[model samples]
Target: MLIFTNMKWQQALKDYKLYLKIERGLSKNSIDNYSRDVDKLIKYLDENKSSNLPINITSEIIQQFIYETSKTINARSQSRLISGLRSFFDYLIFEDYRASNPLELIESPKIGRKLPDTLSEEEIDQLINAVDLSKPQGERNRAILETLYGCGLRVSELINLKLSDLFFDEGFIKVTGKGDKQRFVPIVDITQKYINIYKNEVRNHLKIQPGFEDILFLNRRGKQLTRAMIFTITKQLAEKIGLKKSISPHTFRHSFATHLLENKADLRSIQLMLGHESITTTEIYVHLDKSHLSRALKEFHPRK
Candidate 1:
């Protein structure tokens, strides 16, 4: 067992990052988010000239920091920051660096569930149709948008998608989601056709980078596309079609789930396909389409 009574903020944070990465199997983005929360507290302590270590930091100090933070950020961001700090303190306690979490008594700000925005089927069709086939990158863009909606992929998952992850005969593509969890989402034939065209015609022509040869999506220089690029593509398409509603790659994911629920797909199946760890996370789709619930009631309820 390791012990450190006088561990500095930087050292504790370094160890916490490793714990998050190795022990928790969290993605790099998640580790960075958690570390940012602790970094904020460290900054506060430095500015105030507080010499408290991880083992001796008091709830009052943390509370003061939180109060100062609330002025600048929205309630949702504040709540997430609190939750992230709470996780850090919990880790410190687990490792015996502290007797208890300083954040245990702190209450996160109450925020209502923000429903995700979705695109209608017609809107999705319009966006896809807006892609100019004459452009060199047009086929690739079409494939990317189709894959985003068809597979219900997160931006990270869509970008990290590999050529080897495709199983066309089985009609499913492997997706690596948050925490490196893998799931196979079924792909429709139309989606598959676009991917094949991009892979065979557009992608094959590019001179792929050494490390990124296996990556499914590549930019003009044959490097993996960044998250920002995906956002830009979607935004430009929306603008080109004069779409009024604000949408992103995630909007496609939300539309996928909402459309499925509207067609009477089971919550559990949707949860599995979306790679949601909890059914409650998937339950939000039910609110997106209330008519499905009413239809079920009318068809199955004995009184109805």
Candidate 2:
């Protein structure tokens, strides 16, 4: 067991961050989270009279931390902490700081998945209509909202959309997802028209910055729009419409899938449109249509 204490834990942590960034290609936020978890373990060891060393930390100590963490935090937070710790140890293993990951045997908390909040047809209309068309960027804002609801794009996917991806001739847009994987999602003519209008009228007028030539959505400065900016725009519109239900841009995506499911679009089709890797996720829509579920329930189930 080696002690990182008395030695420079901060320096080692800094180097680990570089490794995560350069070698692992992890995002800055992810690297920060991994560092934060390691910091938590180091702080805990300092208080417990144990050595603040990666090699010295035992699986028993890691399990005890989980138990203590559960006492103070909810399951979700504990789960995040467990994941953070796992990533930290994996980094250590790569750096030869630890022989094995201590977190391998620790079980994650079981969390029941909750369905996403969806907007009713009227609410969806209110949200879209809330945009004041008279203002600058109005058409663009409307198009942004429309694309989100109509296409079911993740916020990141929406922000990172490239001009090369839009294939109006084929009626589909190429989307880059988690793991840098790309998939094609069909784009309706309505969304395509508005996007084209915004692109030609507003986006083309901006001073296009270097390296952002392929980006579809650009800010007034002509650089690509950010995820935060997209959220801010949608949030203001949600408020203007007096929508009591709290929602982000992502709520539009949920509403899109839900509306389709309610309208009798096939689950397999919806799953492919949503880019879900599994049918189980698409089946959540089945629960939304309990009244229309196939037979066997009417005959066998006591509740029916």
Candidate 3:
């Protein structure tokens, strides 16, 4: 085997990060996740007193590391970690730092496809209505929930939304999704109405902070809202409505897709609106509303 000399784990990781960023065009969050996966293996090797170089690390050691870590994480996380390590090793191989990837033959643990939790249309209405209109943040909260459900936006995309992205005249708002890819999602009249009310009434009065002037959603202090804040807002609203199911910002997203599927929206259209990279990801909504599938069969099948 052709072995490259003096390739340390740290240097390999640094180079791999650059590769993911520039060559792969990965977003910062994605790059961090990929790097963190490899970091776990490096931590294990150091603690175990293994002196394996990046080019010289054997599959046995990698397998043992995975085995040890798998004890602490669930199957889904373990699968992701294994996939991440595989990508890292593949990068090393691509750079000719090693002749083969150590994780090449390792199998990921079997995991069932986890169904996403969704709120019913009535539940959604209750949750939104539960917000106290008397409070100064009420309009903003209402608009936030409306936008989340209306656009099926990921929490990251919601928080990062800007004034420049809004195109109400065109009936579409630009969304920057995972990997910084931008797509236009249609906004309904009601959602646009609430957003306009919040923008004109609540957001207009804030002593806007510097550099956050264009950010659509802002904290009371006139800064960008954190992802945690969005989760907290959803959790509070869910509790206020006596909702039993555990929910997050993602629940609204799932509900958005589920409700659409239940109402006979095409999977491909949902995929595009949800900004999913693959139709397979969007197909989960089909599973969420199996009755829709049954109804379709009854309506269109030759034998039915």
Candidate 4:
């Protein structure tokens, strides 16, 4: 095996990041997450005074890193780290930097099927009603929350939504999901009304920046909203409404799919609307729709 330096590893990681961005078309947040796993490994190697280079590092050493990481993070995070490292080493093999991936033999920790938290219809109503509509951004915030629950948008997708994506005439909003993959989600009339109110009454009056002309959601500076801002909005609302269950912008999305499933929406339709690549990902919502499942069992089951 050819010996390499830490600098080589750093360079390889940088190139990998670029490939992820340009070739893979991954979002910045995802790129950051993938890069962070490698960063963690690098940090571990440095702190432990290990001299083994990326090209020559043994699976045993990688295992040690994983072992150390498992001590701090949960199984899910440990699994992500292992997966990330495996992807990085695979990239090295693809680039001819290494003959084989060191992480190929490493196994991920088994994690349980952790379901997401969702809000009841009444809880969602309370949260949305808690928004102070008298403020300048109140309409926009209300619209944002409504769109989140109504459209089942990821926080990133919500922030990146563009005006051109709105197709109210046909009653569907185009959403750019993970990896820049675009999908059209049907919009209800009430959701469209809220969005239109914000766009016409609030968003139109803002001094939009040069490049953000088509961006759907903007802050007071007329620039597009950040993921952090969306989290803050949801967090403040939860606090104001005294919601005990910890929730974020994602909770609204969970509620959206769960509610739909309870209303007899098919798994395939929910998957398409949520931009899930697989039905397996969308099936988790079925677990969240316990009331519907219970009612079905009681109504149809002879034993019940």
What are the per-model numbers of colliding residue pairs?
Answer: 0, 0, 0, 0
104-158, model 1: which lDDT tens digit per residue?
9999989998999999999999999999999879999999999999989999999
As for candidate 3, its clashing pairs are: none
- Candidate 2 regions off by >4 Å? 1-35, 52-56, 84-107, 264-271, 277-304
Candidate 2 weakest ten by summed lDDT:
1-10
> Which regions of candidate 4 fall more than 4 Å away from where they truly are?
1-4, 47-51, 96-100, 290-304
Candidate 3 displacement at residue 161 in angstroms: 1.2
Residue 288 lDDT (model 2):
60
| Residue range 45-67, candidate 4, lDDT tens digits | 87887777777788989988888
Tens-digit lDDT track of model 2 for 13-65: 78888888777766666787888887877777767777656666789999987
3 or 4, which is superior by lDDT?
3
lDDT of 3 by residue, 1-304 (tens): 1122223777889999999988887889899999999889878877777778888899999889999998899999999999999999899889888899888899999999899998999999999999998987899999999999999999999999999999999999999998788999999999999999999999999999999999999988999999999999999988888899999999999999999988998999999999988899898877766888889999999999
Report the C-alpha displacement of residue 84, candidate 2, in angstroms: 4.1
What's the residue-level lDDT of 150 in candidate 3? Answer: 96
Error of 3 at 211 (Å): 1.1
Model 1 segments more than 4 A misplaced:
1-7
Give each model's whole-structure lDDT.
0.93, 0.82, 0.91, 0.90
